[model samples]
Target: MRRPTSGCSTGSRRPWNGLGLLLVLLLAGCGGDGGRQTPPPEVGVPPSLREDAGPPVQVVRLDERQAAELSVRTARVRAALAPYTLSLPGEVLPAPDHYAVVSAPISGRVARIYAHEGEAVRPGQVLLELESLEFANLAADYLQARADATYLEERVARLRTLVEKQISPRSTLDKAEADLARARAGVGAAFARLKALGLSDATIEGWSSTDRERPLLPVTAPIGGVIDQHRVDLGRSVTAYDEMLTLIDPARVLVRGFVPPEEAAFVQVGDTVEVGPRSASAHPLTGRIATINPALDEANRAVVVNALMPTREGWPRPGQTVNLRIRTGTPRPVIAVPLAAVTYDGEQPVVFVRTAPATFEKRPITLERIGPEEAVVTAGLADGEEVAVSQVFSLKALSRFEQYAEE
Candidate 1:
């Protein structure tokens, strides 16, 4: 048997049985199992290494697939020359020294009204006539005082002559002189009273000795202006406190502008202003700033600015409303964007700036001024950067979503 012929197999070896071959394969598979054993725990790393990475960054990185689902759009920001001016609503007012109210100076019956409503009058022109029993009594007292004054003067002269001629005693002459002086003082007091009743010195001095006429007290205009109103009619009884007339000189018209406090700093006493009537067809009136009130209006919270405007044939009346355009300075270059591009993030003003393709970042900006359709950016943005114009809120939403996911 030679021990199965040492290195060679005999034909009767049965070609290595199938069970034995299968056992060999199984052994080979088991030999490599130790090599596949899980990497011995990454040497020096902690088990919670990934957990210690902290929260995800605030950046939103969207691939093309993410942006395709939204209707977001953007615009390139560029430098612009924005106007530096303010438009405000204003009203026409009577100038400070040109408005007047006429009131009854004394209790009287209206005898005649010479100045009618809407009539123009000059200073010292007769406005109306009043007849009063108080005035008649005053006139009578004045005339009587004058007569007594003259008679006492004659009596004083006669007494002096009598004393000088030794016909009357010195005591009697002194009494006569005292009575004459008293009479003269009374006459002076009566004249002063007449003057207080609005009588001119010329009228008082021109009175005739035989004139016993009941006086008609004339009310005269205090200034040259149009008669805006007349309250009294013929025979209408009025008291001293009644307002009988109103006068306003259109030549002294002022445009009173109520500007918001934000723009008040630009207004001064010499700024130019253009004012237009409420009607679109009327021409605009131009003027210069006459005053800028230091205090704000308590009712509207606005700074009051006044412009001295020409009368312009009195087309713009007092208390008439108007529109004002105040030119502050010349236009200059600035960085601005469309007003629609800006939105608020809480109380902070926010804008979305495009950083890369289909990528945006929410940015806070400082606005210098806001025009009708544009906003001037003072900081936090530069020219040539693209900004989201439409559907910017969508970008904000994505940022919010990423925030919630991290939480």
Candidate 2:
């Protein structure tokens, strides 16, 4: 063995050189040969076997490395911030400018109907034809009284001519004048009677020449809109107390939001609000608030707010229910992060903010509700900080469900 010392020395030096190279690689972890990644120790690898073995077995802190990788992804969350809140219940109703109920002015049987349900009507348009014996009788009396006045005037003129020629007494001419005045007075009384019965001046004048048109409807719609409800059909008589038809204009719609009494306290007459159709998936239709009810509903403990929607085509119709969100104040710039940025760690909400390219620190925060898409941070955050806004559950699962077993 002493004679072969150089050869033995060379063999021993070769293994030590490889071991030294491996130690450097394991420490730096990159730009190294893939000869062997030391097999991590199996569970229950006894401490007594370590020195006798050729190479020591190793252990990896897998959970610590996994948590770090997950934290890196959570640092990208960004969004608009809002205050914490609860969504209050609400309903859709007709706009005040567009809704109207047509009713009869007087009791009468409807003879003909011009406007049907879903029909559009204008102001002063005739809606129906009515027939009433009371109206017809009044017309007949006026006609007869007019005929009497015409006959009396002729006789009065002849008698006055005779008296003027000394063929009749002065008392006789005065008596003829009195008789004519009485007939004229009767005509005036009858004309006044028809005027009080809702006979338009045009219709009244038309009645004398044409006997065909009679007992017309009151035509009482003062505003224009579409008919929603029909109370009477042809040949059905209705009264003034009965609602004949309901009309609504689409352009003048108002949105009603039933908000909690506490939330409503911050609402003002000019606050902004958003209205969307029942099927609106994400985006909301916008509008300004027109009114806020000061009193709360005793039954629901909520205050009613009316938001005025402008005339926008393809918007929801009147009485069409929708989702409403009332913005209580102006939007101010604040640190806004996605809902996914903050994650629950069993009982506490925590977020991982990026401290370096590969390093992150976990921070806990209190959440505030904005609208549907974003959340505002009430505490534990600053504006424009890089926080994880993605893959929250993955972070929690890796930290909890994927914990490494102790060797």
Candidate 3:
């Protein structure tokens, strides 16, 4: 074999070096990742993040036969005159004219309490009894006065008889008559005192010396109502001016609300308003505006409105929070549908808009206001679109059932 020359050896090493360099480059490219890759063009974020949402596709498809079986009815949405309503927070309050404050007529100890807080009472019903020595003294004094008057009348009669028979002096007869008049005046004063103490004429007349019962002053209710509060307890001492109890007639209540200054001009006395409890589902209490305060509240710049609301028995208690719905603005043309056509889907008010025969799509609606039987749609509905009205509950049930099935 011929020895390799220096130039050939160096040239051979150079080819090896080139091959090694190529291998190193390939190894780096394929290190952990299989091959080199250009970072992909940033595909933009998710569609939901962009907030471009399409119309809801909640469809309830049914054949004509199925629709007939469900008895689902539809009505065309039409423009109708609708009143503008404003709902304001309000409070149920006792009508001032229908409330009574029971105060102690005389200073005494509370012997008994016949009615308690929240108990119904009738007019003239005894609510409390007071053991008053002062009342007994007055009764005793009246009796004494009456006895003295009777005695003097008899004496005067005798004196008159004597004078007519010429057995007594005329001056003596006159003195007897004067004494009788004075005694009679004393009796009258006593009777007036008893009357001032709230004693009936019959009661004053019925008192006799032989009576065994003490002169107990019975505090009676002046009006029929529920006892709203009791300030005195049994055996508690009370004064003449002390408030004993407060009574309120729940049937006669006022729905009191304050309207914004902008709305104050629209409120008028005798306007019908609907009052309902804030949290209760019962039917609204119907009433008429009884008064609108001429002055505005200094703090809130609102005008006070009072509505005379007739409530059910023992309902709409005083101080209860409520909502007062007042229709103020003139009627305007609006897209309206039957209230039955609307239903709630997880707090969203929606109506089924008919797309095709026996095919309905649930669409959300923005309501301007809702009345007892109709709803005015401000948006999300068209003028002539047909909406499911009758049997809407059945349709809603079916829709919910289908949604669960799909899930």
Candidate 4:
């Protein structure tokens, strides 16, 4: 009985004790029910690792009331021709033929000023009068020469008649003819001198030997313009060729743009250019390049480009600094939007594209060029898409906030 059959014996098995029964129960529990496998311990997984996770949300939603409060306005992206532009500093100048410097034709004292600075004058209008002794001498000489010519002409006529009538010697007639020629030459020389002193041919033709009035030289305007500078006062003594007044026609102007030497190749004669004041609010004037200096400026090494301005009233006065935008390359078709519709995200330009009435997708864009009114988008945008032109900053803020909230 002590060596009795064990629980594991192949013969008749003995009934198990309490300890053996407990061990069997423990082993059965470890093996699971009916030899079925017991699963491993459960583990927690991140939401990102889940098979059902969706892509990141890139859209920003707004209610009608919110959008209205922000004054959000949208514009459709448009296909347009965008030309490359080069910006340069420029100066407003008087057109070459429309400007003049009035100077003294003879040494004289300024007797009168008919046109003051800033006064507009017409062509051939007397701008000033000069009192000079030299003019008096010239007038006297001219009168004397005319008198001698008349006297010699009468003598020649009388002598020719006498010689033809055989009442005077041929030698005497010849001598009289030579004297008349000399007198005519003297007259011509004196007339030239009077004309050189700024006297018109009409005035010279009208002068007589009997007239004793003091000769006054009238300085006339060669062009129609406003007197921009007056350097002489009444009774001021000036010499020949001395500058007395400066005149400029503001209606006809030129914008001279100074371009960098490297950029000169893109500019050519007849290219359209826009000129305006330095203030952004000023309306720009359009013109075509009239000339491009082949040589660079020695001082600044900049190429000089000139554009003739169309006649306009009261703008772009001479000596005024201006802004010049030269359209360089040929324009190409591109998708464009208002400048206000674009915003920056950490230096990355982005635009909010309206996918629905209340939803916008923030999309990055590749800008080919940005102009004063619009930006040319080379990539990441399509024509006919609507973008928020107003309140873009608000949309950017909302996008950032939503992004953080999602994180």
Candidate 5:
């Protein structure tokens, strides 16, 4: 520390005097001039950096224990379900009125068959052609009968002339008359043969012009439907009662079920029913009681019940197995899940109940047959429960999440 010196009235010339006076003041002063303020504490060096406080704040992080304590899923308890109806197992079958078997009408080689198996055919469309020698014989008969009739008329005219002259006997005239009657009868028989041969009048006219012979019957369809089977091939011979093919109109399909004798009593005609697969936007067909087979199966004591389906449009198909929810009893209200939650596992159904934000439990559920989408919860789960309906497969792997975490 340096001592402060006041300038003397008469400035001292000698360096010795100034030095002497400064040394005398330092000796006399208690607090020196330079020692009053310490250097302003080192700039930007924190008091924390100093011993007074600790070091500065650095990185931040979350508490993992708090997150683990939070629940991921939610649910509510439900009551026992009593509102669902009975479901019947059934298969689609062709309706009787819409089914027909097409057969050939004659025994002859099939000249041509244009229709194929499973092909649609319209009524009166030519299915095939069967040709025989009957055409020639019938045409020859018609010609002979017409020629003989012309000859008999000439004879009868001459006979009448002779009778007027009294030269010919009355019995001769009677013979001529009888001959004319026989000729007319022959023409009638010939005409009948032409019709039986299935020759149209126009076809006969063309045949007469070309002097052609060979009976061709165009075996046409009796009803329009898709051919299920074709027995007659091109150039193959077929006879009456020889089935050409079987036809079925798929639009008139039906779902058939066999109701047990006990349940049969409750199922009357015109009862409304629900059907399944439970998929979204899957249109259901309206159905009415078609008929009940009177005889009961001796072994199972089940009676066959056929339900006629409504007009179809790209929905159900024939021979498809379907679950039929027949309303065998009264209706009641119940809690239900979205169509998506329920998944079929063989005969049993299942759903996933969210237990936490990221965890779900595999719960076996029993559903009552109600509607296609809104199925009744007969067993597991409850109302207001959040089920893994969408993105379920993502939850599918969650069942093994703990094992994955360990790995």
Candidate 6:
């Protein structure tokens, strides 16, 4: 057997069976490169452990068509003298001296109403007429006192003549004089009472005892205004000092602005203010701050600032809600941008700055103040830089998507 032909002979020719071939492959894999030792399969770096990498810059690139489809608009940043403005909630109100409460001067029943609610009235315009027995009695007393005064005067003159002709004693003339003086005082007292009852001197002077018509107390407007409220109707009874009508002069109106207590110090009398309806599209009226209340409103803890402005017909009617923009300080040069150009990212205010024709870079900024239409930039922007004023939301979305793709 040729030394049993060495069952494990280094074969001159041996066919590789399936099991032998598999064993050879296993040995070669375990030994690897004949002890030259392959580098541990070149371990890859994880994303978290990658070196020399930073957060991707937020940027959005679009073609002209995409921008146009989004209605993107741009405005250039500029150094402008934008006055600091404080916006406040406000109400349209009648000026203090231009508003009045018409009240009954005497206890009476409403005989007639001449002015209706919302009717315009002028000073001295009769608003209503009241039928009062008390007024009639007053008229009667005045007439009687006047008649007595006339009789006493005639008696005094007759007595004077009689005394001068020696037909009457001098004592008689003196007694007549005393009576005339008393009667004159009574007449004066009655006249004062009539005057106190809202009767003008001319009105009293025109009245005569022979007139059989009953006297009606006329209630007149003391100021030019619109009748805002009517509290009495025909035949309604009212007492003295009872409110019967409310009048407000719409032409002389005020904007009562409620400013936050923290910002009160920035407001001053004589500062320019713009008052308008709460709607932004409505035209605004310019005015100056006339007064500021020393105390805060108890309900809202806000300082009350009154602005005096010229009136426009049918606008800014009393009790209408309004917006007040108070220019607190003089205009100073600052980097400014339109309010539409600003947006927020996780509470961080940001703006889309146009770096190229269709490229925008999201930039964080610090704001000194923000007004209704514009904002003052304190940092992160330069004068003459352009920013996206419209379609900023679409740009922000694109920026976020780009960041995701880069990651």
TM-score of each: 0.62, 0.53, 0.57, 0.62, 0.47, 0.61
**Top of the candidates by lDDT:** 6
Residues 155-213, candidate 2, lDDT per residue (tens digit)? 78888788889898888778878878988898788888777655677876665635676
Q: Model 3: which ten-residue window has the lowest total lDDT?
A: 47-56
Residue-level lDDT for 58 in candidate 2:
21
TM-score of 5: 0.47
Give stretches of model 1 more than 4 Å off: 1-83, 151-188, 279-283, 329-363, 371-407
Residue 118's C-alpha lDDT in candidate 6? 86
TM-score of the candidate numbered 1?
A: 0.62
lDDT for each residue of candidate 4 in 1-407, tens digit (9 for 90 to 100): 37755644844443456668889899989878768867999997876788898534478899888867886788987776655688889888889888999889999999988889989999999988999998888888888988999999999899989989999999998998898899899999999998887678998999877777777889999899899989999999999999999999888888889988755765779898998889783568988999998898887789999999965568878889999999865245778778898999889899999998888999998986666677778888998999998889989999999999988
lDDT of 1 by residue, 281-358 (tens): 356888888889999988889999989888777767888998888876424567788888999878767788889777
| Residue-by-residue lDDT tens digits, candidate 5, 1-407 | 85445455245556778888998898667456655676776667656567777323211111355225432333343443433345676777777777788776556678877888878989777777877555456677887887798899999999999999999999999999999999989977887777665556665444442455455667677688888888877888777668878888877767777676655755767776655543433555656666778889665568877787744563466667776767644234456775676675466676777655554666778865435445567677766676756654444444445435645
Q: Total clashing residue pairs per candidate?
A: 0, 5, 0, 0, 4, 0
Which segments of model 6 are wrong by more than 4 Å? 1-83, 162-171, 330-407
- Report lDDT (Cα) of residue 23, candidate 6: 94
In the order shown, what is each candidate's alpha-carbon RMSD?
13.6, 23.8, 14.8, 13.4, 23.6, 13.8
Error of 6 at 264 (Å): 1.2
Candidate 1: which pairs clash? none
Error of 4 at 336 (Å): 16
lDDT of 6 by residue, 47-152 (tens): 5567866433588889778867886789888787665788789988788888999999999999988999989999999999999999899889999999999999
For residue 136, give model 5's deviation from the true position in Å: 6.4
